[model samples]
Target chain A: MKVESLVFMLITFAVITLITVSLFIKVLKNNKNSDEISEEEQ
Target chain B: MPKNEQWGTRVGLILAMAGNAVGLGNFLRFPVQAVQNGGGAFIIPYLVCFLLMGIPLLWVEWTIGRYGGSHGNHSTPFILDKMGKKFFWKYIGVFGIFSNIAIAAYYCYIESWTMSYVYHSLIGTFRGMDQSQVAGFFSDYLDVFTSTTGIPYEAIIFYIICLALNTWILSRGLNAGVEKTAIIAMPLLILFGIFLAIQGVTLTSGSRGAVFDGTVGLNFLWTPEFDSLLNPKVWLAAAGQIFFTLSVGMGSIQCYASYVKSRKDIALNAMSAGWINEFVEVVIGSCVIIPISIGYLGIDKVIELTTTGGLGLGFRTLPFLFQQWGDLLAVLAGVSFFGLLFFAGITSSLAMGTPLMGFLQDEFKFNRQKSALIFGAIIFLMGMPTVIFFNEGVFDEYDYWAGTVSLVVFALFEAILFAWVFGIDKGWKELNKGAEIKVPYVYKFIIKYITPLLLAIVFIGATIRPENDDWSKLSFSGWELHNESIIGQLIHKGIKYNNTYFSDYFKSEVDGVVDSVYHFKGRDYILISYIDEKGLTHTVSYNYSGNELTVNLGQIVNAGDIIFKGFVINRIFYIDMARLLLLTMFISISVLVYIAAKKRKQEKENK
Candidate 1:
């Protein structure tokens, strides 16, 4: 690939990876919070 | 309404939403638009529109869906009724339902084409075929089930199979069907896309003896022509691509969002989905198609193919390139490529159908399976004409109205309702209800003012543009005329030749005639007559090949005196009339829905 296109591809991958990780972290945190809330109520 | 179906998992919901956004357009349509508009320069406007239009609309639709879902309403009409205080606002929401049904009818047929092509590729049907033969293969496939009347059985069968698959999955309810498929399919789509992109860029030789690096194609895509950014057409193209690639304007996004919990982090999810779609489109999509074509056929041939519309590259041109590979490798590559397309097509097609399914279940309280089956039948029956008569312009008509015009109209309505009617403050709060990151405050004005202004410009500019007005015009080689009837008038006066007629007519040569009936067989013709700005009457005829003939009327014919022949025979008029009638029917239905809603309100008040 051309240098420009290669750079574009790398940047895109980096952005997607960042977003995916963030989403997973948020979901995990939300699940943990819900579990803790339920335990406290019980 | 079955306690308002909710997504089983956050991951599954995001995957399904991403699958909805990532579609055939990502691979096929995006690269072509990018190359045609301004190559790498196109990305500037594209990203600008993504921020200004795509992301904002994504958040808007998600917020609308979640808000409506909280109130036991999933479809657009009821969703808008909740968002907008006035009764007339729900009537405006009717465009959403109309667009989804119209789009799904043709979209399902296109999805079947991918499935059929996948099967064909696996069997090596396109192996060893030349370019013309490959083109002929696609043409012949279109005619395979064609008949004089009713739907072709071949098309009907494939379409039924496609619809049945979608219906069965949708009927499985949210978690088991759409979500599961998305979780599986979206990952495979990305993997397949990466594999193809790698293979495309690694090519070392052309089939016809050209030696080149695949980076040449990459350079062609990324190298910017700065001048094109100044054109309004490029801006519109960028906005349109953003809308299509993100699958924003179609009520599908909102429908999927409706299944999310009201307090879910819609802002981050919407941004992630948008970025995922853009990754598939710009990085993977641009890498796969252009590099492969350029590596196999050279840059010149690829440029020639790009002018023929993006679908041509996917359907006709790339199949020929696949034939140039080693035997086992060729088969493997062909199957994988087409299979990726099939997965992409099915995911998006399913999203198109889901909103209507939501409507049936939420509003009418129909069972999920029953609604799925009924809508499946409706979509199948509606798609029959396009399947049977695709070459006769039925598909194009549906594509133009639903895919192009209605999308913009519905999107414009959405922007207006969210920004102006719902109040930007409320919309922004809804968007950030459970957000992981806050949206920039500048978008407050952008969504309220700039987004709708941009959409209105696109809509109004498209409407006032005369180029699309002449739906009947067969072709134009020179001297642009807006309508097709003028060409029919030229044909009536014995202008039976092409470009030579223009020279001959201007020269006043009465005897310079070319007998070319062989050229005219099986071709649609049109006559056009117009008075020039200088008050001189000119008449012309042409065919689909862009051949033109200028007729000499012997004496000066006045502006209204021009007579047309063969123009009335064009099938485009019938399609236009049908579209007009369909719009009329939608308006009437909108009025009835308003009355019904008012009556329900009255009944509740009396009680």
Candidate 2:
């Protein structure tokens, strides 16, 4: 594969992966905190 | 919302929302769209639109949905009514219900095709078949008359089975039904997608009848075309793809988000869902179809294949391409591909049902069971016409109006309602209420100004798409309405069927001598355009086949002479009937919303 295409693919993929991963982690973290609170109450 | 219908887990809720967004469009539609709309550089406009339009719309839907849910309103008609001050907003919400049922009717039909294909794959029906035989199975399956698959009415049977399955699942209500299905389906969808992508990318050029390396196709997909950013059509395609891929414009996200609890972070949830859809579309979707096909057919052949039809590439071509792998691998590939599609499709179709079910349960005193049954029945009744009359362009008619036009129209109106009428300040507050993460402040401006402006442009561009996709040629001065515009579509602009003649007739270039005239097998449209002396072109359109005309087979016709003229409306009746059916569906749903509103008023007065 050409370097240009490889760089382009990497950049695009990395950008989307970054966006998704960050959000997903936050969602999981939020869920964890919510769960912890409910469990503590219980 | 139902007492039992709230999210059992945040993970389940996120999975279901992601599942709703990450659908067949993410895999099947996006790959074809990216390749056809300037390949590698398409991501530029795609991501731009995602920020400016897609993610913003997601927040809007989620905000409004939770707001409605807090008010005990689950469906769009009531939800929109709760959000917007105007009386018409509730009526405009009819698109949410109408588009879904109308779309679900056909969308489920496609989901059935995936299910049937999975069954066939596991049964090893395609084990010994060559490329043509495997490809031929799709058409043969579509022909309800043909018993080639040894099952009579295989298409209809699968469709019924699919609908029954959906009804059964939906009948279980939120946690057991949609959330459980999402938990099962979404994980498997990602797994299958990853498996296929791995299979695609690792493919060797000469290992198993491949003409080129799989990585070469990846290169073709990601190689940037910096110039494509300048083209309006490319930007529009990216916008449409973003709109559809995220599944925003359809009221499904709103319906799903409406189930979220009060004080939960809709902002983060919406962002997560939108980004997950992008992950599916950009990474997994891009990797599978094009790479595998190019691994076998070469890039040129794959590019050429796109011209036939996007649907054809997925259904007809992929099975055959997978056949290049031997028996075991082929079957596995087929199962994975079709299963992922089925999962993707069902998730979205399941979302389609929620809005209607929400409408029924919240409005009428229908239980979840009754609502699911009624929704399924309505879909079955509405869907049968498209199934039975597939050849009369009825299916395409439903897709064109409800699937494409209705979604855009609904989205545009909702954006206006959210930002302009609701006041972006309050809308922004609603958006950020109970948010887990800080949404960028720039989105306030984007949601208010950029998003709606982009949607309006998309609406106009879609409603009156320029002939040949060149905006420079958009002329409204009685130039024949032979485009994708609503008016053009209403007239069934140009003969879409097999037998038709359409071309520019340059009178000045032609000697007045008679040229050869040909006979049409059937239908309306032998549109002949000729330029006048003043350089203005005049179009003479006629349904010559429907009339007794002087034009005959092998007859000579002079330049600028209209050989045939009359109404060439072959399936215009079906088209009109289809439009009427959609209009009726819209009106009927709007009536239900009105009655529900009135009932709510009466009950409140009594209280």
Candidate 3:
């Protein structure tokens, strides 16, 4: 691939990966928070 | 208010919405559209439309769904009635119902093709087949012209299987069925797309005179023609792509959103789904299809193949290219690729069922399982014409009218009702009600005015442009004029001047040895035999366009004086007329129904 095209691909891949990872982490964090609140109530 | 079903989880909702948006279009359609509409320059209008049309419409649909759901309105008609003070809005909402049912019928049939292709690829059916034979395989599968298997039993069988699978999934209810399938399928689709893209880019050298790598393909795609941005056609194409890729204007998004909790954060979720879809489309979609095809067929041939549209790229050309990778590797690649397409197709096709299920449950009080089965059966019956008459323009007719035209129409209705009649301030407040990210205040004005106007323009422009008319004819003409060899051959063969006109003399030149004649609309085309200076015989044809004859046969001429004529013929075909009349009748009847219902309701109140 051309250097510019390769750069473009890498940038796009990184951004998508970051967004997906962040979303998953957020979901996990929310789950943990809910679990903690239930434990406190118990 | 009726008790509405809610999504099992926020993650499931987002994934389901994303899967609904991401489909065969993301992989097969976007890359071809981008390349054909001036490559990187296409992105300018594309991004513009995404901001002006796509994002705003996503918010509109989501907000409408949540708001309507809070009040026990899951279907568009009920949702629209609740939003708009007038009953006419509910009637306008019928577009959503009609569009979903109409699109789902043919869409499931297409999904079946992908499923069949997966099985064919897995079993190595494409192996050892030459390009012509590979092309013929798909043609025969569609039973176009002549059937290779004597009957279209395979098509019917696979189609029924696809319908059953979709119905079974949908019958399982929202969380267990659609959401669960999307959670599995969407991730696999992305992974498969990425894997194929990696393989595509790594292909440095190709066989069979395809001497280029993936870079050539990427360059072809990313290279921008700045001038093309000025063209209205490019803008229209970009806007249409956004509408299609985002799955906006269809009532499915609203139906999906209705399943969300009334207080859930839709703005952030909508944005997330949109971004994910774009990532799949622009990044993975472009990365895989274009580069791989270019690596296998060279850029020129890939470009030529793309002009034949999505089916040519996905079904025929890609399978042929896979076979070029030798034996075992070809089978592996073919299975993975077709498998990816099957997943993508099913994910989206499942969404098409949602609006119907929601409508039935919301209106008739049918249970989810019963609704799913009845809807599936109706679609199976409705889709029969497409399968039985695969070669006879039935599929194209449904696809063009229901899938393409009605999408824009319904979207326009949505924008107007949400932004204008329902009131933009109210819509904006609803959009921001459970938002994680704050949408800019200016979008309120944009949603109210600009988006609707743009959609109106697109609707009118598409109406004016003839369906099935090839826009590339002008480009071909321009290319022929620029090429010395082609122009020289034409001049040498033709004894006279080349201009756009229909004369009886030119018609007489090919009348003597005419082999066959076909009539389309009011025009007669004659195919005649001619001999060159080398004594090689060939068949050439000319079209009679009522007032003039325009011939642009690429290289069919052997020897004869032929004058090429161009004229602006605005003749409407029967299909176009029927489509226009149907749309007009639908809207008119809707208006009449609204008025009659309103009168009856008012009388009841007075009594």
Candidate 4:
């Protein structure tokens, strides 16, 4: 691949992957926190 | 709010929503769209549209769904009905239900091809076949009348099995049915995607029988046409991609969102689903078909194959390329590739069934199992023409109207309803109800203003596509319609230089009742269409139009009788009939909605 093309491809992929992973982790953490809260209430 | 049936878990809900958005388009259509609409430069507009249009629409659809679900409504018709006070709101919602049923009809048929390919892959049907022979395998499958492949009525059989599978899952209810299937399928889909993408990027020129470097294809896909960014059409193309790719406008997302529990974080959930689809499209989608195909066939052949469509490239070409990897690996590649498509297809098709099932259950008091069966039967009936007339133009007709046009129309309406009609203030509150991640405040203005304006641009750009795709050069001085434009498609009016395609035949209005059509041509033929008392019909190589030798067929045609039968080439009635069938289906669904609302009114009065 040309350097410019490779750079374009990498940046696009990295940005999307970053956002997806971040949102996924945040959602998981929120779910875990709720489970802990309910467990404490129990 | 989530009274009837709720998603089993947060993960399941997200997966289910993701599964709905992440479909065949994510893997197949996205790359082709990127290639056609300016390659790497396309991503800028794509991301911009994602923020301005796709994400905002996702929030709005979810807000409408949860609002409706809170009011004991789960379908688009009743949801829109509840959201807006006007009666016509429910009618606009008809696109959600009708488009699903119409689209599901042929969509599941295409899904069946994936299942059949999986079967063929496992059995090694293409083991020793050459290129044309491999391509012949697909054509044979499409020719429903023939039974060359040992499976008699092969197309119909697979279609039944696919529909049955969808119906069975839908019958299992939302939690067990859609959510459970997503939990399993989405993960496996990702795995297959990752595996195939790895194989694609690692492709060497001579390694694994690759004819060219796979990385070369990646370059072709990623190389930006900076010049194309200056064109308005590129932006419209990007906007259109965001529109279809996120699977908004179609009632499927709204129906899925309606099941989400009240006070659950819809904002985060919608974001997760939308971004997951984007990840699959941009990262995984770009990695697979185009790279591998270019690696094998070279970029020139790959570009040529795209004219047949992404489905063609994925189905007809990929198998032959995978065959170069030797037997065991070829089988694995085929199974993974086709199996990935099957899961992607089923998840989306399953989304289509929900709004119909919701309508039946909430309105007519049908149970889940019964509703699933009815939905299955309706598709089976609607799908038959597309299956039998697969070679003819019936399938494309359904896809053009129901799948493409209906989606844009519905999305436009929903955006208007959510922001303007329902009041953006309430809709914004609805989006941020639960205590998860707070949505940024800028979306408040974007949702109300920017998204709808972009949607209108997408709509106009699609319908009245400018000449040469140059919006600046567009002029009304010598205006001529492109056959592909919406208005041109509606009336079948355009200057078709090629006579190979069927729907290209212009359906003409009655001018003088066709005095006579004289047609004879050696090299090329121009189809001149005119209407008589009977209806639409066309003539090729007529004396009045283009062509040298003209032979009048007045003696064969009775003077008093209608000269033409409103048909052309081979698929005379089927194309027109397909349009009629979809129109009838839309009206029928709308009628059902009206009757459902009336029954609800009666029940309330009695109470």
Residues B3-27, candidate 3, lDDT per residue (tens digit)?
A: 3456666667778898989988988
Model 1 DockQ vs. reference: 0.32
**2 or 4, which is superior by DockQ?**
2
The residue-level lDDT of candidate 2 at A23 comes to 87
Candidate No. with top DockQ: 2
Candidate structures ordered by lDDT, highest first: 4, 2, 3, 1
- DockQ for every model comes to 0.32, 0.74, 0.30, 0.73
Candidate 1 per-residue C-alpha lDDT over B126-235 given as tens digits, one digit per residue, 9 for 90 to 100: 87788988886776567745422233555566778888999899888888888899988988888989898888777666443325667777778887778888877688
Question: How accurately is candidate 4 docked according to DockQ?
Answer: 0.73
Which residues of candidate 1, in runs, are more than 4 Å off?
A1-42, B1-3, B146-153, B206-211, B466-569, B577-581, B584-599, B602-607
Q: What is chain B's TM-score across the candidates, in the order shown?
A: 0.82, 0.88, 0.80, 0.88
B1-607 in candidate 4: lDDT tens per residue?
1237877678788888898888888888888888887888888888888989999999888888888887888889989988888989999999989989998999999999999999999999988888778887887788786666888899999999999999999999898888899999999999999999999999999898888887988999999988888888789878878877888999988888887667667888889888999998899999999999999898767776785479889888889888999999999999999999999999999999999999898898888999999999999999999999877689999988998888888998899999899999888888889837788899999999998888887778678875556576567674555566788777665433223234323333223333444333222232333444545343432212331322233333322233233234535456678999999999999899989989989999999
Candidate 1 local distance difference test against the native: 0.73
Q: Give Cα distance to truth, residue B239, candidate 3, Å.
A: 0.6
* Candidate 4 RMSD computed on C-alpha atoms after optimal superposition onto the true structure: 7.3
| Residue runs of model 2 more than 4 Å from their true location after superposition | A36-42, B1-4, B475-482, B496-569
Model 1 residue B578 lDDT score: 44
Off by more than 4 A, model 3: A1-42, B1-4, B144-152, B206-210, B465-607
